[model samples]
Target chain A: MKRILATLLACVLLLSCMSFAAAEDKKTLTVWIPQYQFSKAEDAISDQDFWDGVFDPFEVENNCEVKVEIVGWGIYGDTFFTSLVNEDGPDLVYVTDNYDLVKRDLLLGLDPYLTQEQKDNVILWNTAPENANGEKVIVPMDDGVAIGYVNKALLKEAGLDELPVEWDAFIEACKTIQEKTGKRAFLQNWGATSGTSALMLAFWPYYFQAGGKMLNDQGEIDINNEAGLKTVEFLKSLLDAGIFTEDIVTESESVDKFAAGEVAYIVADLNKGNSAFTPAGIDWEYVFSLKGPAGYGARTATDSFAVNKKTVARGNDELAVKALMYITSGAVMDEFHSKIFYLPPFTKDASFVKDEALYALTSAHSEDVYVVEEFSAKKSFEDTLLANIQEMFQGNLEPQEVLTETMDYYNTQLKEN
Target chain B: MQKTFFSRRRRQALIGGAYILPSFVLMFIFNVSPIFLSIFYSFTKYDMTAAPVWVGLDNYIKLSQNKYLGNVLTNTVQYVLITVPIQTILSLLIAAFIAGSLKNRYGSFLRSVIFIPVIASLIASAAVWDTMYKPDGGLINQFINLFGAPSVNFLGKKPTALPSVAAVSIWKSTGYYMVIYYAGIMNVSTEVQEAAIVDGASPIQRFWYITLPILKPITYMIVTLGIIGSFQVFDLVYKMTGGGPGRATLTVAYMIYSYAFQDKRMGYACALAVGLLVVILLIHLIQTLFFKERDAK
Candidate 1:
């Protein structure tokens, strides 16, 4: 009887060791991000400090080994897709809004892993990812707003007391600034070719304010309408006024010109207020949306994080779910905002930013913030529009001609796709 | 004995073949194989991630309909036409000057100076040029201002952007071609030049009649190299302009990159690549037909 007991005990111990080994094997996770996103000023190859501070803490807390890999931003999307299709990608990936994950069907749906209560805890309205079928795909980190950053000193030199809140007034202010300062009042980083996204960022506010929609609910291009024509005319008027620099067609970094005080007002992301404008030490302030005839506001794109479904099926679903939770949590979201100086998407009861100039402008334009869901489609219509706009910018085609051509192209693409 | 001799010859042939077997296999695997595979891909509709679907000659048909192709083709032709002649002529001139006038030590030092740009990284040089082309405080504008001329936007204006980029290409490659010409000039018999001088020919006349005629082979080589190099231009344009201010500088190479990588239209990019290869092959065949070496005495 004693011999039998000893054999049973040994068997139990062996089973326990096997189970422990299996558990340990499940703990490893791989993460990938663009090399430039990490602070690697000295070494260039590795950001040991960032890894030790930001990533290592999480790894220890979660009892996992986090392998951080650097990827080039230009090729990241293509590389990520290739890796995913081959089923050899990292468990987590860092991507920008350019990915349009939902429409592409490239990312995993996290809904199956989370409980209803957990899903509810996630700020769905702000962070929810919409698939091509309008299904939620991932949770967003933040919603960005594109606003006009005006150099107050430059404006004052042009005899402007405050930022203009109307189209005509804005144009007049630009003319005045140009006349007085002998500098370009308005500048954008496109030289002869209309960069679709950059043009959209600059001109979409006017379109929205004019009660124009790029695409209707039926997926028809609406830019050939009267409102859209007016938007084009407005852009042409700015160009004709000599308010734009001569090389506006080819200028890659118009923001640098704004930073150098060569332009009074520039259309840029709100995050630039800290990282770009502030670092340059320019006395700049944000301006509210200029009122158009339709009384609508501006629209901006967003970026989100997504999971790989195949990874979940590989038995690390629990860890992946936990990682999603950690990244999208209020604390982590706030940290991202602080690091990037971007507007946080999640709702937190923190004190309002006390920068009087920024607060006043942000509050005034808060109602005008529109989220564009153009990325929710499998194929982007933006490319076609950009090509047409480029022709217009190059003076090869008239603005109206561009609009008509772009509308037709977009319609064809939608119909076929 | 006759039977044994035939067997030995066969054995020798087999051994010779075996010696080159690995290289032949590698070449077929890496170079020849990929070209055929790419041709197959060109006849398909591939999105890189997904399996390719056969579409007959759809990619070629689609290429004809593509509006951007016209601009890309125009840009590529302009680049080749402008850069090749300029680089070849400038290098030949510089080589002639160095070979004729300069003493040995100074000539080598000057040649080394030109070769420095040839050895320098293209991407790094392009980046420096990008900064120098900046409208605000770039060195180019500063120099332009010194000339009592209005600062012209070099890369910003559509009409000038391509030419501006071409200038950088010429600057980078002229030195390489110069080295080739210098070597060619060295090989030319000094006796012929002395005879030309004795015949009451001026320095320029001697160079035009005697030196140039003799340097035909080098000229042909330079022209061919320039044509091939210009067609494959990517790194400089990518770093400097990104094929923009609306595809002003977009070449077939850049377009292929955009299609295969950015747009994920792998089949289309492969079709473009195949088209480029065919064009290059035709040019090379033409060059070979015209530039064959004369029978040596």
Candidate 2:
């Protein structure tokens, strides 16, 4: 009986050790999501709760662990690269992947890891991620069109019942708002806080609406054409008139006053504005479709998911691809649509959008969505242009001089490249 | 016995070297090596991701073509000149005042209070000052409004933005330099002060002719460090104006950072950094020479 008991105990110990080893072999996946993902005040679902609810089944099914870290947006870009270089980079990084990151060879191409079914789920965008070698490495997960937001109560107080559809009338309404309320009229960001946000959110749409594009077929800047000049002059006039508040100079300073009912309107999408103002109980509405001489053009940004090269280098590419696939899956995207008010999900079956107001803004300005090549050259080009634009706004340089300097600077860059 | 004596001295020297070996190793690893490595990086296009590509003198040559280079340098030099003197003199004055009474409870309390800003984080101070400097609903503007004056856009207008940003730097640094000056003032030979007093010298006369001359070495250190700090000013400017309202406050340090990190022109940024280092080193050498000549006199 003693001999039998000893043999049984040894067998049990071997089984337990094997089980522990199997558990240890399970791969861990890390996803870097911005802290802002939880979105203003937890009035909506917290990012952790939403992801936990969405990902629990996946983790259980695969017997793998998922670690989600909420990185702040300001430091997100730096973290994205540094973490990769250090070899502990997340399996997946959630960012608005600037074409620059693609050019830098920091991300792995998804083509190899993605299955036919997964590729079928990909959304068609005006521009897809193409790395330096023109390989599609990242895919768009969500899209948002930049429209206008208005504090309706303030507008009503200014004796304007309708939002202005034309730029001239917009200026007139701004003057009226200032005259009545003794508050700044519109709050347009004139500074390059995010280097290109003011351009993307405010000025780029105007330039597009006026029938201007940054580049032509040969990849040369047709930037300072007639429409571009008109766009600049229009902004210059608005600046000279002092429609935007002095607070526009700082990057982090938002149009909080607009939401607080101190300013009339701001050039931000309804979804973007609502995330902040809704928590504060600010009654805001989307008022957009900025019509110019040519037509309406919208500011569109893609929130994308890119797999890290390090993940593939470590032979975890399949797992990383699966994680991205799970994120952009119909069910997860559908939930995100409702919670975050992102544009209709990319997956065809997950075309879920929550807010009727978002649909209204999207339908109103979605067709006019503008695209730009934000690759390696874009940062330097936009930086030079925006600095000169700031100079023009401050009365240090004329709009003509601003146009000349900006054109010359980027053209030189083009030649050099 | 002579051989034994030499052997004992050699052993003592080895023991001393062993005691300091770790510190010497650490100093080289942390400080000396990075300086040399950075010099090498200055000549190569390194984006931290890929292997560095050697570009000879191309990066340095690009500096001559930078259109805003002169303007940025002007902003940097103006900042250093304006902030260093004011910071140094003000700190010395405060140090002189607080040094005499450091023994009492109130005096110690004052020292702690003055040093609080020095101890606080630069980024945090910049953020707090951002709120304080706002034109609307800001502390400074609120106070200015009490006088029934029009609100000033301290950070918005070109004329005031640089000075406004500089004021924040000065406020953040004054306490730090004050502590340094106070330490030096504490070390002032009491015998000299007593002799001056005995010779019927007034307080002002003693401070000017006796105490001032004696504190020259500490003053040199404070000024040199202050100049370097002013040149390297970035956090406040980055958080506050971001070199704007139209490049009103774009310092050389901030530009270097932007080029390196934001633009990813690593070699060009390193070249700019090397240029800045050279300029500061030249100033340091000249200042050291002048101080040595004065001391020799």
For model 1, the stretches where C-alpha displacement exceeds 4 angstroms are: A1-27, A35-48, A97-104, A124-135, A192-197, A220-222, A276-281, A312-317, A347-364, A375-394, A409-416, B1-26, B189-215, B292-297
| Alpha carbon lDDT at A36, candidate 2 | 43
Q: Give the least accurate 10-residue stretch of model 2 chain A, judged by summed lDDT.
A: A408-417
lDDT of 1 by residue, A1-417 (tens): 999999999999999999889777647766665553332235333433343356666777877777767678555666776776567677776655434344457676666667776666654343465556554566654455677788999889988898686777778888888899898787765541323455557767788887787667775456798888887777777776777544666565668778887778887776677667777889988765667778747776555556765676666656766776666666655554454344645434223242556556666766786665543222234545554555566666777987887666544422223
Model 2 chain B: ten consecutive residues of lowest lDDT: B258-267
By TM-score, the best candidate is: 2
Interface RMSD to the true structure, each candidate:
4.8, 3.0
Tens digits of per-residue lDDT for model 2, A173-245:
8888889988777776665444566677767888888888777787666577888888888887787677854
TM-score of each: 0.85, 0.92
Docking class of predicted structure 2: acceptable
